[model samples]
Target chain A: MTTSVSPVRGSRDASARSGLLASRRFVSVLGWSCLVSMALLVWLGLSVAPTDAVQKDAQRLMYVHVPAAWLAYLAFGVTAACSALYLWPRTRSLHYDRLAGASAEIGVLFTALTLALGSIWGRPVWGTWWTWDARLVTTAILFFLYLGYLALRRVPDDPQVRARRSAIAALVAVVDVPIVHFSVSWWRTLHQEGTVFGEDRDAQLDATMAWILLWAVVTFTLVYLFLVLRRYDLAGIEEAADERQLERAIVERRSEAASSVVAAPEPVSVAVGAAPGSAP
Target chain B: MTDAAYVIGGWGLTAGAIGVYALLLQRRLRRAVRSLPPEERPPWA
Candidate 1:
């Protein structure tokens, strides 16, 4: 008889018995909606939006770059909030720990996108592939900080110890987000002030461009929503599986000890029961 | 690179990054569901 360890849905909650990602229909609906929104986003950004007065076609990069940056910030924000919740005595739960880990991983993905798109845009406008500008430097730091957070999560430790350490690390790393956002204004840099939120209207995008940019932001935000949901669901399942495996190992070890104490020689192959093995 | 090239590359890479990440999530979700015990497995999964 083969027993497979499936991912965790809290058996504790009867209402949630179907599991966290049980809504396949909901995911399908969301997936279709995301496809339509993305098609519209590309159309508006690539076909309808007017060429910039200065940067010309290169300005189109703004559509994707800004949204990616928005998601990076949003992802990290969720991680920090969830980490805080996990650490709080009143709201402590492994669910929040899993959520924080998932969000951080997604955040790292978007941060890399933000940086890469920024570099691609910079090459044509700034005549360079890279720059040590304050915003760029700070964003780079933000990337590595979360990367570190992800690494910390992988370290072998007791669940409580790992979660506590990761929570503190996540909170500390989030301090860099504000610094990255404000870096353009606070220091002399090649990067210009934000187009959407700039104080100078003259420096901002026109009505048509603004509308398209708004749509782009909405589309990407929806994309972020879709990705985070799936990622968080996976995290929940993975943690549940890990907990089950740990429990199994403990049981096996106890059984082995009991048999040994009785001077009963167990089959050597039976001792392999606690070893980590893949599911069939 | 031409301005048009930059635009195409920017959007392409952004889309690629997002698409790859979504695919990776789906793959992991599948594996996780498989690892679960029959009794604990989500019906939808």
Candidate 2:
């Protein structure tokens, strides 16, 4: 009768199992697509594209540089959104905190790549590897801000307390992103204005170069998506393990208390029986 | 360095960083999965 009312497996657990399988399938497919697209993108950018009139073969760096920049911006944007969701009382979930952290990790990696690629491209063009240009400085600051956000996440504290503090920090750091984006136009800086925005971009880049750049952006975005999914899964597993450890500690403490209570009962009975015999 | 060297260096570093990170993530993920009980393991694991 009890077996009829209760199934061998929980409905919630079964649903979670199915969901995990579906997402795994999706991530694998996306990972393969990203790999194949990147292979084609590398060949197209490195071998087939025409040399720039000014930058020469060094111009090929643009393929990776532009895409890295875009992905960094995108990753931080997602972080900010997830952070916002985490802070809102009605909508808050630990998953939002995990998502924000995962995105920030990827964001930091891409931001580093942006700086490195920019330095490489600049060395051949601007004749120096580093500069105090508005855009460059702002971008460097933005990188450190997110880097600090990652560091802040490491401070040991209560889970809810840590998540709240990190979410606030994330929101504050994201303000630097807009500043980084507009630093070129807002101030007379060494970095050129965006090649593809607010200007005659079509005339600026050859059609083939533009197509290849778009492909690179799309391919890298897929790579970003894949990495975040796996990273978030890792975060979830770690959190679950932490919870299990806490529960086990509580269980062990409770059992110790129960054993101590049972050991005290014999002494109490002897004392009571001795008092009654003495009174008689 | 020549322009070709600069080009190769840039692409090489990007690919190398990405490949290393992917491997590390995969390794950590496998360890995390292995630590879990069979009933609690994720579907992908």
Candidate 3:
């Protein structure tokens, strides 16, 4: 029995193509906005903002370091949410799994940057490059948790198995986030207490610095989204390739089986022809 | 060098490191996408 399945697959491909086209404009707009915002942030932070009286030029690290840490937390939160969605069978979606993977990767990068930059800032003020203070230690733990999450995804052979396990890891890692945040409050630490604007300003920051920070946050967020979307798209392509590979293998096996069946009848035909031919 | 210079250098190096890392990631993503077979090209691509 010949079962035709090609049309269904073709239609699925067509739908995916149309969906991509529909989202293209949105992605481009967000990407450009991110680029523009990053430029503005660099200009304002490096040029327009005044040098600090206390930390002096080292204060400049705030522009990058603070934002990097914030983005790391944001990315991890998204990872946890996506992982949860993936774990629940009713809400399970490859999109969510791909998003969790992308977020974990990006979050790890930012977390590392936060530590590096924090150390740079700390060296000048704290008279040392490294410390095992509460905030610092908790941040390190948070970073490793996500690193483990990324590694877990790489270990499993089956996609569904990877997704489920990674999702659980993502969820468990989220507990570290709140710990990282409250570490300064909970314990005496070398890291300064959280500030509203400038190292504990309850009111507002200088208008220019505030603007720069706002733009920086916006730009980084857009950049994060772009990265995640690109990564997710790559995952989808990989899945399609895997499916195609399987289909090709099946087709090849079936063709081989048919050839064997055809060959079996060929010997009988040869015997009949030989018997019927007197010359033979 | 003055203290101001040291501070600037530190922040500058930090920024440079992060920027380079970002570029590396973008490159990796591009390579990954390019390595895919034509039939497996992402719908977005």
Candidate 4:
């Protein structure tokens, strides 16, 4: 009679299993809400809101450009936070490393979108698609820095080594974000100085337009959160799959070893039987 | 179409793009999860 061991019921790291599920649910809800809110906000901005007297219809680009820039900043901040968590000796966690990698990928996407949309807006309003102004140059540099961070994550095969190196790169790259923000104020740039969330009273627009801009900001923020969460969940899934593959390989090797041990005596007996005139 | 029409068109296009992208992301996530082994599937599924 053979006794079989039941496959370790619910003992295989339940916490990680549950956490992944929760993350998946959270991402789903966030993503759907973002879609609905963005749709409504766009409708309000384009059809119901009043246009600017100075820029006229072209000002509509604000709906897309501002949101893209805002999301880019938010995504980079997330990457920095995750990277710090990954690097801390007492708190070095693979979860944080995965989060950092995922957020950096999304950050690059939003940053590219920001630059492209900004260019589109600038062409119509500034009469040029490209500028050498302080704000524009700083922002472009920030975008490239995150791109470098993403590329770093792909270079190494060892997960722990890759995480450590990428964390260092992310920490160094975050310094550019602040520099980008202060560039417009520190230098004479064709780009307008900070106005929307700053203390520049004269640069402020009318109250209604401000409200519309606020809605746009909120909508874009929701969308960023949604995308980041989704990306993080996907990363978690991939990590889990890799772990399982490793576990399966280990089990297979052990089983092979046990079978070889059990069959060792049979080969010895066959060799002894064929030694002299035993077969004849 | 008036100036308002242009504004509406622009906003509509932006919204549509975002919506499509989000949907595509959802589909990708689902496919990835499905590709995982039954035991390894994320707990939420």
Candidate 5:
């Protein structure tokens, strides 16, 4: 949650510290574009794209799985970058921490989707649901690493302390993303080598399939942008609500203390040498 | 399972997961908005 927030109504920015794309109009446009493009992508991927001569219908899984993995990387990259901003003294702000948390949460979701879709595809292509191959294992490790990052954020503590700890953890967890990507190349494994962004950077994939894959990636990126914007907005409002609650509680406690002091009887006084029944 | 089944399953799972998350986020935002004074609520809320 951002501290020192400006009213969001008719505001160009989300808050005093909002990022460049935090405008309400921009987010709304992006949401509409995401929905339309995603529909187009789905129709083309399922109906228009040519079936693989080898993998048959199972090849369709590539349209979603690759993009999902791409989103996982993109989301985590945003998290790490934002976390760095939070860690830097000059750029330090709670906005970056909330943004990082939002990105990491989306990253974890996409990672799960990637793993699940990959498993679904593997059943037909690799003839197994899962294997202990380097790529699969490394990807699993990356998933858990981010899961740990999210769990760390939930531990009750000072907001700044939590942000610092989460920022460091995000930077550390991001190291595995590259490892997962390169695992297919670094070691001999059951997983196939990357066709597009691999060591050779070959564009050897079929033309129709490649086009559809590219469209899917574009569509998913739009969807990610929309989701992140909405998530950031949600974070802002939720934090505001939390602060309001805290303030209300403080007021209630102060009033209760004041009333108790007022309600107390006056202190009785008597001369030390005087008897109980005698007057001073 | 058939190839068609897996394909459908993968796509369905993606949609379902994302749809559920978006819906839940909307619910949380609405609840939060209700808790705050009108002046403090975000435009999107």
Candidate 6:
């Protein structure tokens, strides 16, 4: 004896249940972790960390700004790697294409955040809101380059064509990342070189503040990972919808063609002599 | 503006930007999941 099961009900049940952290549970865990870590970071960064001798309270902005800049680099790096995987013949797959697109989008968001935070941090420290410094200019260029890459992905085309072209564009655009990173050193610039990894390797930040900064970086990385996962899942669902829509259109067009092919009597025949027995 | 004001503004902007983006993403995911048929809905949705 077989029992009938409602697929909708089963799906809702499965979705509601909490799975292992490797799958569905990751979303909830990551969301809660981001919230908790962010709160802790704010407290540690603002209240606990000692104010800088020169920059004072404004130095606190470094915690978020630096992490954001790092996350941007990380996201773009992921995009480039995924794009390469998608482009290579052996490992080419739609999964890599979607992952590349997702990472690039998140990268753009973080890049925008990095720029804004840098400006905010700069206004008090650097005595200017905007500058054409090497670091700032390179970062801005990086942002726009990825923005253009995203626009390329949106142009209506076959999936494979879009993926192939955008993969190349992603690779091209990622070249700005290292330039942005080394811009402070590459030119006479208003932005200071990295204190942690500068030519003078002695770190400027004290232990507590340094630890908080490190924690913030890790927290932001987790947040970036969470966002990328969610974005990738959304891409899959949206792509599936597109595929279904295309399938429906094909079926509709086939039906319309079939109806059009149905035979019709000649107009001059007058319905085949009035059905052969009607009143003349 | 004071340095404290700048710090607060930067932190606030970070929180707000991330919060808004997450909310928007959740909405988009829900919409996409709903558009697909029951049989086609992703298990994680």
Work out the TM-score per prediction.
0.87, 0.88, 0.79, 0.81, 0.89, 0.90
TM-score of 6: 0.90
Candidate 3, which segments miss by more than 4 Å at Cα?
A1-22, A197-201, A204-207, A253-280, B1-44
- Among residues 3 or more apart in sequence or in different chains, the pairs in candidate 5 whose N, CA or C atoms overlap within 3 Å are none
Minimal lDDT window, size 10, model 2 chain A:
A1-10
Q: Which window of 10 residues has the lowest lDDT sum in candidate 5 chain B? A: B36-45
- State which docking tier applies to candidate 5: medium
- On lDDT, the stronger of 2 and 6 is 6
Chain A TM-score for candidate 5 is 0.87
lDDT of 6 at A183: 83
Candidate 3: lDDT of A111? 91
DockQ of candidate 5 against the true complex = 0.65
Q: How are the candidates ranked when ordered by lDDT, highest leading? A: 6, 5, 1, 2, 4, 3
Question: Can you list the residue pairs that collide in candidate 2?
Answer: none
Please provide TM-scores computed only on chain A for all of the candidate models, following their numbering.
0.85, 0.85, 0.81, 0.81, 0.87, 0.88
Q: What is the lDDT of candidate 2?
A: 0.82
- For candidate 6, the chain B TM-score comes to 0.92
Clashing pairs in 3: A195-A200
Tens-digit per-residue lDDT, B1-45, candidate 1 = 699998899899988988888988899889988998887776576
What digit string (tens of lDDT, one per residue) describes model 2 on residues A1-280?
0011122121223223212212677878887987898899889989988999888999999999989999999999999998998898866766677789989999999999999999988988898999999988988998999999999999988667888899999999999999999888899988888876555544567889988899999989989988888788787676666666676788999999999998998987888777654755
True contacts kept of each: 0.94, 0.60, 0.25, 0.38, 0.75, 0.81
Q: Write the per-residue lDDT of candidate 3 for residues A1-280, one digit (tens) a residue.
A: 1111121222224224212212556766866776677777777777888877777777766787778888899999999998887777677765677778878888898898888888878877788878889999899999888888888888846666777888888999999998888787788888877744434557446666666777777777777776666555555555555556666798999999999998898888787876654774
Q: Judged by DockQ cut-offs, is candidate 1 incorrect, acceptable, medium or high?
A: medium
Q: Which candidate's TM-score is highest?
A: 6
Please count the clashing residue pairs in each candidate, in the order shown. Answer: 6, 0, 1, 1, 0, 0
Deviation of model 2 at A224, angstroms: 0.5
Cα lDDT of model 5 by residue, A92-156, tens digit: 87778888998999999999999999999999999999999999999999999999999999897
Name the weakest run of 10 consecutive residues (lDDT summed) in model 5 chain A. A5-14
C-alpha lDDT of residue A122 in model 2:
90
